[model samples]
Target chain A: MVSRRGFLQGGAIGVAGSAIGATSGSLVANALNNTAAETATAKRQLPFYGKHQMGIETPIQAVTNLVAFDLKPETDRSSMLRWMTLLTDDIARLSRGEPVLADPAPELAIGPAGFSAYVGLGKSMFIKLGMESDIPAGFIDLPAFKMDQLEEKFSGGDVVIHVAADDPIALSHATRSLVRDSIPFASVRWTQSGFAHTPGVVKSGVTHRNLMGQIDGTANPQLNSDDFASVVWMDQGPEWAVGGTQMVFRRIAMQLDTWDQLGTKSKEEVIGRKLASGAPLTGTLETDAPDFAARLPNGLSVIPDFAHIRRAAPEAFKERIFRRPFSYEAGISESGSVDVGLLWCSYQANIEEQFLPIQRRLEEFDLLNKWTVPVGSATFFIPKGPEPDSVIAQALFS
Target chain B: MKKIAVLLASVLLLAGCAPAGQVEISDAWVKSGEMSVEGGMTAVYGTITNNTDKEVTFVGGETAIAGLVEVHEMAMIDGEMKMQRIEGGLVIPAGESAVLEPGGNHLMLMQLTGDLMAGDMISVKFDFEGADSITLDSVMAKPAEGGDESYHETEMDMSN
Candidate 1:
C-alpha cells in the first residue's frame, strides 16, 4: 500500500497546491478588503473564532465539500498536535483572506468567499491515538439499518474536514490547501461534493429543495435559539466534548429513473404533503402540522399509514434534530441512469436518543424507502470552536 | 456493488416468448444473489412482447418461490418515490415489449417458502388480457460481477 508519507516525500505537494489555487481566479472578487464584515451573509468573511464552530450553526453556504482522511500508521499524539496546530492556523488565516503557511499561490486566499471549515474526529481516531477513554457516550458507530447498502469507499475514516463557501472554486481551493498540508500524516479516503440554492435565489428563510424536488429540512430548530442549543449541543460529556455535538452523515442514493413513473397523487400520498406546496395532506401551508387523525370522504385517513412524514415524526419535543442536507450528483452510469443522491447530514446532542429512533421508524416501514437506498454512513464527534489563541480540541492532548 | 450488478442484470434481460399469436416471453431470469438479512424478498426480470395487433394487459401471476407474486411498479411521484402494487395489470402496447427490470417495473415475490440459492429453478405463470395463461421456468444464475471503479472518479482530478 502507498502510504501518505511516501506520496508527500516525492515533493509533489507544491504542484498540487498551486493547481488548486490557479483554478479559482474567476471566482474571487476583483477588489480586496482589509476590514472584515460582521454579518453572517457578508461576502468576504465569516468569523472563524467563536464559542462554537461557525460552520455548524452559521448559515449554510451555497457549496460544500465533505472530505474524510485516515491517519498514517506512524502518526502519534505528538504528530496529531502538530497537525492540529497547523490546521487551526490555516483555518484562521484562510478565513481572514490570507494565505496558509507556504501557500504556493497566495493570490487565491485574497477571497475568503464566506469560507468556514469544521473539523471532527471519527471513532477510530480515539483507538488509534490511544485516547479511547475520551470517546464520548453516544459516539459509537450507528447500528446498521435494514436498507443500508453501504459502499466501503464512502463509509469510515479517522477524521473529517467539512469545508464550505459561497463560491465553489474557493471551497475547492481551501479543501486542497488543507489536504496538501496534511499529506505527510494523513491520506484522503473519500470526498462528497454537494450544492444548495445560491444565496438570494429564494426567500431568505425558505427551506431548500432537495434533488427529489421535495421541500426538505422544514422543521429544524432556529439557529441560536434555546431549542437549538438543547437539541444540538452537548451540555455534559468528556471535557473536550462539552459543547460539541455528534454528527450523522448518510449518503442516500435516490433512484429517479424508476421514481419518475409515479403519478402526482401517489407521490403526495407517499410523502403526506402537497406537491405544489409542502403543506401536510390536510393543511394549507408548508409549516402546518399534519393531522394524522384526519380522514377522507371515503372514511380512510388522509395521509397513508406508511407516509414518510408520519413514520419520521417525533413523539415528543426533545426528539427533534437539526438537519442540514445537500444534494449530490456523481454522474451518469453505464446503464444510462443518472447517479443522484442526498448528502443527508444531521447534528444532535445524542445519536442514540435523537436520530436512531427516527431512522428506525423510517427503516421499518416508510413508503419512501422503495426508491431510495442508504449507500454510505458514518458518525463523528465534532469539537466546539476554539478561541483566537487556542487550537480546536486542544484540551484533548492534555 | 454485486447486488447492484445483479439487480441491473435482472433489468437487462430482454428475451421472452409464448406459443401462438399473443405475447412472446423470453430472457426470463430471477435475481437472488444477496437478499437482505430480512430475507425472502427477491425480484424476477423478463421481456414480454405483444405479438397481437391489440394491446395486452398482464392481469397477474403466481410463483413457486413465494406464496404471493405481485406485479409492482417503482417510480418517483411528486418528489416522493415509492413501489406500489400496480392497481390494474401492466399493459404491453401492440408490437412493443414490456421489460420488467430493477429500478423500474419488475416482479416482487414475497413470503418465500425457502431461500433461493444459485442453480435453483423458479416456476412462474402469468395471465394476459386475451391470450392463454403461460408458465415460465427461470434458472437462478450467479450474481453479476461488479467492476472496481473508484468512487472519486468524477471529482476534480487530484493527482499531482
Candidate 2:
C-alpha cells in the first residue's frame, strides 16, 4: 500500500519536474504523469507585493474564504495597527509557501497554490478609528434595495479579509492563520467560503457560469487593460487611498427550483442571452454589442426592455464595474430546499458613479430579479497594496 | 611559536569575533487568558535566534502581568499528553533558531496579575545564559485551535 507520506513526496517531486518541463519550451512528451502536470499548474505562485493587492486584478483562484470581522469594543487605533501588522506579516509569509509566525501546523503551508489575500476596510472602521473625515470620496454605505432580504449575520463588518487559492488545503491554512491573528483585535462577523473551477479544468480566459448556468461576467473589462484600470482602480481619492478601489459585495441567492420551471425561450428572453453561447439575442458572438433597438416580425424589441442584460447595461461611458464573483453552495436549507447562490463582488473607482446607477436600474425593473434575491450586502474600500516590509493601510495609522 | 599562535586565536574569539550578534526574537505572541477567582495562566510562543558563537540558554522570563514563568514542554506521561516544566533551560545552538510553538515547547506564565485579554500587549523580559536579557512586546491572542485545553487544565506532571 502507498503510504500517505510517500504519496505526498511523490506529488511534490512531480510538481517540480513539471515546472522544469514547462519552462524548457518542450512539449512534455508523456514522460511526466498527468497528475504531475495538473499539480504544477495548481501550485503556481502569485507574488504578494505589487502595485495593487494581488487578488483584485489577478485571475480568480479555485477556492475563496471571505471572512469579515467586527472590531472589539476595546480595540483602538493603536491596537488596530498591531492587528494589521500581524495580519500583513502572515499574508506575506503564507503567499510565498512559508508558515506564519508561531504557526501550529506549519506543514499545511507548503503549497501556496496561487495564494492571495486582499484586505478591505468598511465604513464602520473609519468611525471606530475616529478617521471618518479621511474616508475616501465616493465611498459610502450601499443604499437599501427593494429586493433585499438582508440578514444582519452576513451584512456588515469593520474589516474584511478575502483570501483565495487554487488548492483548498492551502486556502484553508491561509484563512485560518489570518483569522487566528485577527481575533485579538476583532470578532468574526461572518465567513463565506466559495469556489470556482479548478485551475486546469477549464481554459484560462473563459467566463465562468454561475449556479443558474448562465455565463457571468462576460461584460467585465479585460484584465490589465486601461479600461480595467479606469473602472477598477481609484486615482482621485484621498492620497492614502489612491490606487485603491471600492467593492460592493452581495450574497445573491438563486431560486433555482422555480427558475427551472420556466420555458427555455422565456429564460432566454429574461436574460437576453442565448443559453448555448451566452450571445445576445441580436448578436452571434458573446462580445458583440447587443442591438437593443432591433425589432422582430411582431414589432417587438428582439432584446426585451425588461431583460437583465439590457437593464444592467451602462447608459453612459463611465457607468461600469469590474466583476470577479464566485459560486457558493451551502448544502440544503432547513426547509429542504437546495441552498446555493452567487457571491457577487464588484470593484469600481467610484461606487456612486459606476455601481449604484446600474444597480438602481436593475432594482427598478429587471426580469431576472424574480429568480434572484439579495440576501446579504456590504461595501468596503480596498486600500492600495503594501510595500515590502510594510503593513496594509500603514498610511492610515500615520 | 605554537603557544603564541594559540593565544592570538583565543584573543580573536574573545574580541566579538563569534558571529558578532546578540539573541533576537520574532513573531512573539502570548495566548489570551482570563483572571478568574483562582488566577490566570497563558503561554508565550515565538522564534528565538541565537546569533552568537556560544550556545544560549533560555532560563526563564519575567512579566508584569504574571507572577511566575518557566520553560515548558508537552510530553507523554502514563500514556496521556501532559505539560511539564523543563528542569534545565531550553538551549539554542550558535547561529540557529529555536521555535516555541503550540503542542510543543513554550514558555508558561502563571498567576497572572490581571486578565490578559485580546488586543492587549504585555512586555516580557527573557533571561538567558551567556547572553543579555531581551525584552519584547507580545500581543495577547486566542488561537482557534491547537491543544488549547492543555494550557487551561493547569495540571503539570511533575513526577519526573
**Which candidate achieves the best TM-score against the true structure?**
2
Per-residue lDDT over A1-398 for candidate 1, one digit per residue giving the tens place of the 0 to 100 score: 87888778655877777776775643353222213222334356888877677677866677889999999998877667656766776788778766654454657765777788988889999899999988888777898888899998889889899888877877887887777656656889999998777766775442678777788777678887998999999989876788899999999999998787888888889899887788999899988989999999899899999999899889777778898888888999898898988888899988888898898899999989998999999998998888865678888864
What tens-digit string does per-residue lDDT give for candidate 2 at A1-398? 98999999999999998888777645445545566865685568888776687798877788898999999998888777778777777788788778876677888986678899989999999998898998888898999989899999778889999999988899999999899889878999999989888876766542677888887878889988999999999988666688899999999999998999998899999999987788999999878889999999999999999999999999998999999888999899677788889888999989999999999999999999999998888999999888774568878865
Count clashing residue pairs per candidate.
12, 0
Scored against the true structure, residue A95 in model 2 reaches a CA lDDT of: 80
Deviation from native of the Cα of residue A135 in model 1, angstroms: 1.0
What lDDT does candidate 1 reach at residue B63?
A: 77
Best candidate, DockQ: 2
The DockQ for candidate 1, computed on C-alphas, is: 0.01
Q: Show the colliding residue pairs in model 2.
A: none
Model 2's chain A TM-score stands at: 0.90
**Per-model DockQ against the true two-chain complex:** 0.01, 0.16
